[model samples]
Target chain A: MSVILPGDDLGISTDQIETSIGPGIYKVPGIKDTKLIPINGGLLNIQRNKQGTRQAAHLESNSRRYIPQVSDMVIGTIVGVYAEYYKVLLQNFLSNVTLSVMAFPNATKKNRPNLRQGQCVYARVSSYIPDLETELECFDLSTGKDGGFGLLDESGYIFDVELNYARELLFNPGFLVLEKLSTKCMFEIAIGINGKIWLKCGDGVPIPGKSTDEDSDKMDVDYVKDLKTTLAAANYIKQCQKVSPEQFDKVLAASFKGL
Target chain B: MSSLEVHAGVLGNSDGSCLYVVNGNKVITSVVGPIEAKARQELPQTVSLEVVVRPVTGLSNSREKLLEEKIRNLLQNIIIGFKYPRQTIQVVVQFLIADGRPEYTALELNMAINSAFYALVDAGVAMYKSFVSTVVAVPPEQGSSLIFDPSMEQIVASKSHHVVTYSVEHDECKIILLESNGLFEMKELKNILDAAKIQCLTVHEDVQRDVIESKLQQDYIWKS
Candidate 1:
């Protein structure tokens, strides 16, 4: 696909009756038929649904700021804790979003899930109103259940990537970036389209908890390994964004050197 | 022939930034926007633009303010603001070096507009069209033709200088702004704008397209 700059007429005319436009596309509203124009410089992606009647078009660009969009799964840091809700920050220097205590599954007034500042949560943007605080929830509203959306592993390390790369890591099933890392070490990762990622390897960072001296000494060795692997894995994943797939193996080796 | 160099995504913290140098003029611009807007900066139905132009030396004065206003007006026409309602896109331009006469601002404005274009595209701000600007100098000599992108020496010899801006969409260039100073006729002005149209289109094709293509290549290295 050729890169489409802003204001370039997308060669693909929107002749279809039903076309859903996505990011980086500006639609002229109140018109009889749809007229789509690219407002950002990026690769223009157009895909038809299986039925062939519906079409989806969007421009994919690498941008730093993450705008809150409904249904987008994001990893955010809890920055503000309140009685009724928690304020989460997806990216620095942007407006904060709210995660209500009751939005979590099985959360009650007295039994609300406890989350503190500096903690991370994996949640979906539940609703968005222009000029107002965005709302996030940790439960699947359609199914009325938790869909792996809640407080992330506290022992996990969180890092940032370009927004587009994070999307590819999460949505593209064919992408082997994660699979390659799995070969190096066992890890559990949550990829947020907002560019923040939570990754944990094995038992995660070593937390000093109460344990017998004999048990702690043996556990300490494994704990150190996990921490190193986690750091290396994060570095490898981050480097993947800069290099092509063929270079992934090389980057992985460099990241895990001496580990 | 004058020299031009463009480097995009140079600033680590900004959403998008470009360091553009043309001839001896150097300008660095950072575009950050559709982001959290302050109370006064917010607009009801469209995104707000905050353009700040800093001079090469000394504190910002009316000269910088005028350039800022001109940039804001030019951006107001090209940017598709409704897409980012209640948000603001901030464009900050700083001039590191200038080769033109201090009294003649045609070159400074031209450099700033082109630099801002690259910065905005780098930031990924939605816009209706891509644009470029060029300075044309009408020499005082009886048989001299309009000079495209005049140098300091040429400006010193010219009777009049004009800054022409064009918004390009679909390979077509439409005049956006024309700022003229000194004595020049409507006939010479017509030819100046006509030549500027060609200059703008060439800049968009040879300069803007090439830079964006290279940047896109790096951005989507995995795809290839």
Candidate 2:
């Protein structure tokens, strides 16, 4: 059997295959359907398989496109609620992830979890809610063996960031700005991409775990105050990280957010 | 709407894995196995889901922790925690880029979950189904345009925007998660969701292509 070599060029040249396959020699013919796969190696084996080998060398470069599939596990935050579903943020406008009642077998029309704005949760890919406007069903828990829940009513710093700044900060990483307060330590944070960083550190506090806060009001002023310095340090570090190492050294001297 | 590219098994030795990108924003996710539970750990009838979100640049403030919890919740729901008791599946998502658009990065993270699903399969873990995530953003201005997946620039340029992450499982579109500013309305909400679904399909197409292409490549090389 002759092997057709794949090539980057539009057409495979006949002269490209300088070798041949025969009864004795190890050389294998590299042409198929008159097309050829480029021979980058020496001594090609031309053994034929029962099922014909599919010519797939013409595959295009890989695309990094993000798609939501049924039964896929995903992470998202509570953005809002529509009539029958919660409008969730999948990551960016590149995609929207929805969790509708239809997807949740156990979810009752009345007892379904109240998905609030700013809340976070995880669900499964139940199905694609079809329409001119399509969506992903995220409630069928039968595909996997585990069930997970998301965070609720947790407060953090929000920052307004420049695109370049956000990218730099993401690649480098730093902290959120914290402000000391008599009642509540405030965090003025700017998240990159529409960057705005606003936070409140309570009186000398350790960061709370995910389960600590069911309501934002539960956050005490003392906790905010305590976290002020840490948030400030973290924010400073993040901002500084966006700058080059050398640039950070120079900018730190004049940086005003820390103050 | 923006496009996302997601790759699974981008890293090594992780139980579940993925590399996801929304346009230019990048997020990599890796899941470690359902190993033996800690001696003191009590969940013997189920597996534990630990999610760590590595921000692009800054320390994960309360919000990031909250994000982790959000991820944990969804994963816990899907991972059949009790199936493998006293075990842990560690999901590590590293945000390579943010582009100022949280939704963009978030969408990448969602895609990473799908990739992670494959990685989990690659690691020999069984699951009920696979899922995908999409984001919808809407500007606050009364008459401003509704963006499906706005870049950081667009989100910031607008007064406010909403991001919603949804998925489909068992032939139904389920609301998996959501995050947004406090101020938003119904009209804008519907528009964002509508647009986002289109974006989701686009991403799904790409993912399918990539997976097929990868298998082809592997077969070509392994056979050689």
Candidate 3:
């Protein structure tokens, strides 16, 4: 049955929630699992029952945006690094959750836990700060006798990316092909949606060909300059939209300065 | 591949401008005016929609040319070009990240178009239609039982991929453009299209919401 929100909304309408829907009635994604009983005004409300608090029944409405909640397992990557904390990207939300080094039970100054950009972690949503629209904490906390917060099982690496970078990876086929081509090496490159790339290796060796030192700085500069020139022409073509096939050389030359 | 943040207000004082990513790759875009067209390119009583894609670091090359043609065709189908005579609307989409998902580049193309259109609306340009676009995928492992708005991981893990594009105005079953390397029955195609159509409707609604909110924020909407 097609359950319609007011104004024929596919899900919960922002207007209806703000003005019309009462407290007893709610729209949730998995509410039916509880088998809620019908109450006054056609509202389906669930009451506490004998079987250890019957599961809450939910009917996901299209308009409802899911907010990350504590204990909710989510997949996120480290987007930013702090002295002893890390910022994580949880999809659909604007803010990143923080994981402090001290939160881990075995974390120490020498084994000083830190978040690396683009490192994906399976974390538990710890807390939310409504005023700041930020998530206060996330942890690798689990009851399986696993070592506390420092670093959990090192299954894989994660990438931190900006929104634009994520969008590009999501859409561009060439990037996937390039990664496939580069996969022979030990490192796994994680591209974050927020614009961060993280390289992780089981051997603990940093990816080859990239220097984390002064010399690498020069390489990056060269790369950015080349990128800028190529970008300028691409921008030009995009603006014109319909350049003749013959004009291709001219645009490419004008944009890619080195060529 | 890495993510990068980019933005463009308007380069060349065009109708609109955008900054986008190309699979961890980077690119920028700008739209030019609805200007008087050249004699050969002119339509006696219709406006024209043009598309161009630029690579971030190399020559125009064959691949870029192919993309420009393909994007132009897709745009033409959506745009109500006849609304404005003797006018030209140019779209520039640059490649920032060139990753493994070639078929997915069209997803970026569509996003840039939406951004450009948003700019055009802000610039007071008129249009007979508002195009709605989406990337619909059918995964390799899931067979045809599940359709998804694919993420990079899902797309990469899958053995084969199919990306479909749709325009809301041309609301017909066969109107989609499917880009895929895998095989599927016509029934699967129909199912994917149905899923995509729903997504297109959602996007259309979202765009309308954004437009309305922007107007409200600017106090452009009359209050009761």
Candidate 4:
């Protein structure tokens, strides 16, 4: 499919009874409701509901900067600890979002979750009003449960990738980058829509204080190798998206060599 | 037509970056935004743009500021700023090479506008329509043909020069900005605008489309 640039006629009209627009598209504010145009440059996607009563259209685009969107899952690092919320940085140099102390799974003012500064948390953007500060929650709004949203362990290694690549890794079923990677080494990854990937390969980064015996020296060396291999793994995952899938085997082999 | 060339999404640090070379002018532009806006510059319901134009050797003065102001006027109209409230989109335009004299700004202005278009598209910023700009020079002699993207010598030799920009939407063009200098008659102004519009469309169809296509291809390389 050819990529669509801004101002190109989408050919899809907004005359439908009910049309729900997604990202990369916006109603030209201050204009009549008859026009719907794509604001971003990317592939145009228009879909119909099961009954065909409603239509949806969105543009699929990629960028380094991540704009907070409602319901977007993001991994952020706590930069400041506040009384009511925790200031988090999703990407460097962008605005900081707030994760409320009570946003955790079942908490009250008296029983607040005590999160400190410099901690990483995987949370969902609960509110994203452009005029107001963005808010994040650590629980699923449907069930009021953690729902895999909370502070992440320190053992995981986090790296950044393009937002589109992260979306592909999360949504595209045919992509085998992860599966091919699994055969070489075992790993766990948490992907955020904000172009961040938290990956843990092997035992993850080595903790130096875990061992206290004679084997401590050897264990430290082993963890160091794990760190090296982990670095190699991260580098491979970030770059493999550039080359076609057929050469993944050769590229992966080269990356892991001498580790 | 000095063989227009464009390289988009080349910078890693900025959100979007492009390098555009055409008609003896080379410009590099970077777009960083839909980001947080400072308190003083913030707007309640519109995204404010901060444009910076830096010259080749030294600091930028009034010459760059005027270009920045003109570009801002055009971009504010084309960009869907209301979609990004209380935010800022900053564009930094650096002229790497200028074939014209330091006193003349018509060529630099055209290059800046065109390069900014690519950078914004590369950054994924929302724009209502794509815009392309060109400079036209009318010679001092009568009945002489107009020059498309006139070189420094051509611009100085001509009696009048005009920079015209058109917003290309749905395969149609609309005049969005017109900056003219020197002397020209009303009839010649009409001719300059018509020629500039056609030139803008040609640039968009031939150079801009292919550059964006290659950018998308590189972005989605894993798919194939």
Q: Which ten residues in a row have the lowest lDDT in candidate 1 chain B?
A: B98-107
Model 3 stretches astray by more than 4 angstroms: A1-259, B1-12, B20-27, B98-116, B123-125, B143-147, B169-176, B219-224
Could you tell me how far off, in angstroms, the CA of residue B175 lies in candidate 1 after the best superposition? 2.1
Question: What TM-score against the true fold does each predicted structure earn?
Answer: 0.95, 0.42, 0.39, 0.95
Residue pairs that clash (backbone atoms under 3 angstroms), model 1: none
Best by DockQ: 4
For model 4, the stretches where C-alpha displacement exceeds 4 angstroms are A208-218
The residue pairs in collision within model 4 are: none
lDDT of 2: 0.47
TM-score attained by chain A of model 4:
0.90
* Model 1 lDDT per residue over B1-224, tens place: 78889999899899999999887778899988768789987888888999998888888888889989998999998998777788889999989998735687889899889888888888888789899899988889888778888788888788998999999889878888889998977987888888889888888888888998888888878753
Model 4 agreement with the true structure over A161-200: per-residue lDDT tens digits: 9898898888887788888888878887888989998888
Q: Clashes per prediction?
A: 0, 155, 58, 0
Q: How big is the positional error of residue B25 in model 3, measured in Å on the Cα after superposition?
A: 6.3
Cα deviation at B196, candidate 1, in Å, is: 0.8
Using lDDT as the yardstick, the better of models 2 and 3 is: 2
In candidate 2, stretches whose alpha carbon ends up further than 4 angstroms from where it belongs are A1-259, B1-3, B100-118, B121-124, B140-145, B205-209, B212-224
Task: Rank the models by TM-score, top first.
Answer: 4, 1, 2, 3
Expressed as tens digits, the lDDT of each residue in A184-221 for candidate 1 is 89999998999999999987886567453656556677
Q: Evaluate candidate 4 and give its CAPRI docking class based on DockQ.
A: medium
> How would you encode candidate 4's per-residue C-alpha lDDT over B1-224 as one tens digit per residue?
56678999878899999999886578999999988889999899999999999999888888888889999999999988877898899999988988747678899999999999999999999899999999899999998888888789989998999989999998899999888899888988997898888888888888888888888888888775
